[model samples]
Target: MKSSFTFVCCMILFSALIKSQTSLYMPLDIKKAYANGTRNYDGTPGKNYWQNSADYKISAQIFPKEKLLKGSETITYFNNSPDTLNYLVFRLYQNIYQFGAPREFGINKKDLHDGIKIHRIKLNEAEF
Candidate 1:
């Protein structure tokens, strides 16, 4: 099942890439780095550049009868950047639905039931 989903997603992405041929906009510093030979001019890569990605295991279930959707994920992040880590940032968008979270507009009162609950957060198997 996962293989089929991955195949469909890959096909869609390939089609979009072929059709759009999107180009990334590099900043002035990145262009300068390329000019100085620290990075490749044609987007090959950079010498001091770094990137990071993590494999995630996510499972979600939907209940049409209850009108609810629940999901959980385990993400093991790989910090391959050539920089020291201070802290990780997490955004809770559901806080926009909080009763009085300094919103630009208003939200439904009934929707203020425990916005974005994080049962546990662990780094290196040690809770922070």
Candidate 2:
């Protein structure tokens, strides 16, 4: 009788342990927790872009010719997400031509009466 009782207790304890290990806990104040850098979306707080580390950099250059404009931009995107992401989407901006000339206005392509031009699209080596 004692041996059977011990076996039942052991089974109960083992089941509780397994349940605790597999169960996921959801915090109540998830947003506040993230703002405090406790529950960061990237698994860690200091490694994300908000920490301002020297692991990556972004720069752009533009040159204008007599009738055309040329530009080149580079982005050093560091792997900061918890999951290893391969592909990334980047938005490219261009100046709209009005009356056969480049117009100086805010980034309102829809408001412009001219067409849109895509400069370049690049895929990083990490994407491969």
lDDT of each: 0.79, 0.55
**Residues 6-81 of candidate 1: C-alpha lDDT, one tens digit per residue:** 9999999999989984787779998788876667867777676667888999999998676566888899889987
Worst 10 residues of 2 by lDDT: 46-55
- Each prediction's TM-score versus the true structure: 0.62, 0.33
After superposition, the stretches of candidate 2 with alpha carbons farther than 4 Å from their true spots are 1-67, 93-128
The TM-score between candidate 1 and the true structure equals 0.62
Model 1 lDDT at residue 88: 80
Name the lDDT of candidate 1.
0.79
Report how far residue 46 has shifted in candidate 1, in Å: 2.3
How many clashes (backbone atoms < 3 Å, residues ≥3 apart in a chain or on different chains) does model 2 have? 0
Backbone atom clashes (below 3 Å) for every candidate: 0, 0
